[model samples]
Target: MADQLIDSEIIQRITKKKKQLDSIRPLSKSALQKLKERFAVEWTYNSNAIEGNTLTLNETRLVIERGLTVKGKSLREHFEATNHKTAIECLEGLARIKEPLTEENVKKMHAIILRSINDTEAGIYRNVRVRILGAVFTPPDPVKISRLISELFKWLNSAKMHPVELAALAHYKLVRIHPFSDGNGRVSRLLMNLILMRCGFPPAVVLNTDRKKYYDRLKKADRGNESPFADLMAQAVERSLDLYLEALEPVKPGEEKELIPLRDAAKGMPYSPDYLSLLARQGKLGAIKISRNWVISKDDLKKYVEKKKSKS
Candidate 1:
């Protein structure tokens, strides 16, 4: 049964391969192009959603480009508003978790995620009791939730576990506790990405595109089967890393003389060509002028892109 829950060897292999690949994989041009495109779309969508705008893809793009603020719509008007809140909460939750997780941090994340919702205690753990999938999962009685969470953080601090594996475990444990009445799924995933970002990895956005697979994997993990969940998470991580690498093409050995084209530099960027040119003029970028064309370094463009992202 334990073997069925988690494949120890597979876990080991994933950890080993992740480390090895991190060291050897060089950024490829094609991958970088695809990554930039995806990131442009994702950032537009996510930032709008975070700011309480429930927008479709087209609307999101327009909003990002035109600087339009969503107005007159209640928070509930957004598509899957509750879920969006959950996702946003997840991202914000991660940003605030200090290294070496703590009882305070867990509660802090829970509180932030559940702020406006009416859940028994709102942000507090259930004092009564509850069950999940017919299994009675209870929070620590009264004050014990804090203590148990503290201990969990302590274990996380001391364990020699790979950060990714630790992320997976944290997700499982968080859901098992069912700390909040709602938003546990979002919180768990947010917690997962929090660990990932802290470990120098990019954020993994789990789109609603694979809702069925997502829930099914979670159910399987609940039944003492972890591989399905682990595999799903691994794929998500790989996708995120692939996109990130594609966005930021690492400088290769002896390639400094090969100038990056302006069109290519702005390939995945969300800003306009005119805006990019202005940025270059401000000494914010290293650009090359051609016959009626301008090119900037991928690195320089990335900084401008990030600056826009920060403002959004």
Candidate 2:
């Protein structure tokens, strides 16, 4: 359980591969714009899924514009409700963590994820031992789950790892522990983004498109070869960062006059602060900035807004 045993070779390989990939795959401004559009659609789709309504990209866009929720009466129904609640809870958890990771914060995050779940010890560390990939990966026994988790948190603190890297590691570790009986995948992904968001990065999306690659890499990591998973995660992080930078590209001054600050625009709107912050951080804040404080021109804001609207 020593940090050295975690294996740094994978980490080194990932670092090298990331550099090579960055050299060959420079993200253009246009590609970033496309990513932003895709992200907005994806966010809505995922959010809708949390609400029990499986949505296509177009449907997700519509749901975002016109609020809709699925009405079901089964586990799926409960999942939808809990999923939406869990998403919001996850965002809130991100807001609570500060600077280096802390044991208290990790426990709080676990609690947020299991808030309404029916687990025997909802929000608490696992008491019974668990296995992964059919192997007795052996987490600390139930009696030791809490202390072990705390130790893990301490290790995370000592690593002083970058938020993106920490998020990736946390995801792998949390899944490996399988602390909860259900909702582990969703919770782990949420925890990953919580760490990323705390580090000022946009949330990383694990697309169904790359699900196989994701699983394969995770399996490799579980077998004590962390490089493949680390590299895969790094690619996801790079993709997210590229899209983020693209969204933030400055607009031509004086292009659009009617653009208002998102908070001001959302004064009576139902959008959450987390959502608004994402917009601002990603450079989609034209609609959120006050008109008087508009840094970019009216025409530019108009153009950007129109482009975004058109895609929606």
Candidate 3:
């Protein structure tokens, strides 16, 4: 009961924050474009990395941006990054139409994920039964894969659960089914974000740093526990919402100043991010807190530098 109450509280908080975010709808075009690009690289890197892709985040960005391959990474790694980007674009199209989740849509995405890598298995159901290493649950039989997927889509359409819960459940159920020969995890994550995007939430990235927790939560869900997985999804959505809301905060006309993160503000300056953060924390810099990060205006950094020069 205590855990249930806590989960309820968290759901309420997520809903409240989501509502606040929706109130600021239609984020400025530039900010929206930047957020989309940023999330695309991040989502691709983390999703592929969680599956053991060796490309660093910077390397992933380079491949996506410059179409340049890294020297040390495998060809498959590069394809994974590009393929996942294509999958995100496909998700965006579905979200625009508010399309209901379907097995065909899922297969289309799985095909994109495996494109140029495994032509035969791409977008097709598995004929051989396989086990997810380290998972507590085994996926359904090969013969039942289509049926299970159809049932999942049916439930998704009729279920009236909260959007976060629905997204988590969609991911969890797909993983349980493991319908495809490969790319199941990647496709499942795509489906999760598809549900979220259609429901007006930003894509919730399950960071590679949290790979262990992510797997553990899925395992817990396998054991008939949904709280951990649901909590994880809610937190992911909330983090994205906070980021979007912060980036999209409108500027007032009379204000001649704006705030930027310490790292961005420190660019081309002698000060490093850590040094700037220290100054902000010490109140020696004209900076303000937004969420857990500190932001400073260009003018404020200039003033701080001038004041230091005079003292010297």
Listed in order, each prediction's TM-score against the native is: 0.56, 0.57, 0.79
Ranking by TM-score: 3, 2, 1
Per-candidate Cα lDDT values, in order, are 0.55, 0.54, 0.82
Q: For residue 64, what is the lDDT in candidate 2?
A: 40
Clashing pairs for model 1 are 32-246, 262-295
- Model 3 earns a TM-score of 0.79
Where model 3 places Cα greater than 4 Å from the true spot, the runs are 1-6, 251-312
Better of 1 and 3 by lDDT: 3
Report the number of the highest-TM-score candidate: 3
- Model 3 lDDT, full chain set: 0.82
Q: Candidate 1: lDDT of 170?
A: 81
* Residue 121 in candidate 3, Cα distance off native in Å: 0.2
| Candidate 3: pairs in clash | none
Q: Per-residue lDDT for 94-197 in model 3, tens only?
A: 99885576888999999999999999999999999999989868888999987888899999999877888888889989989999878989999999999999
Off by over 4 Å in 2: 1-67, 71-93, 96-100, 110-120, 133-140, 251-312
lDDT of 2 by residue, 1-312 (tens): 243322243334334424543544445667655654566456435533532345555555544444454344344434433444446445655556677666555555556545555545556666566655434355546676566667767777677665556778888887776666555666677667777666555566665555666777777786788756655565555445534533544444643334344445544444564675565434343322221232323333344456677899
The C-alpha local distance difference test score for the whole of candidate 1 amounts to: 0.55
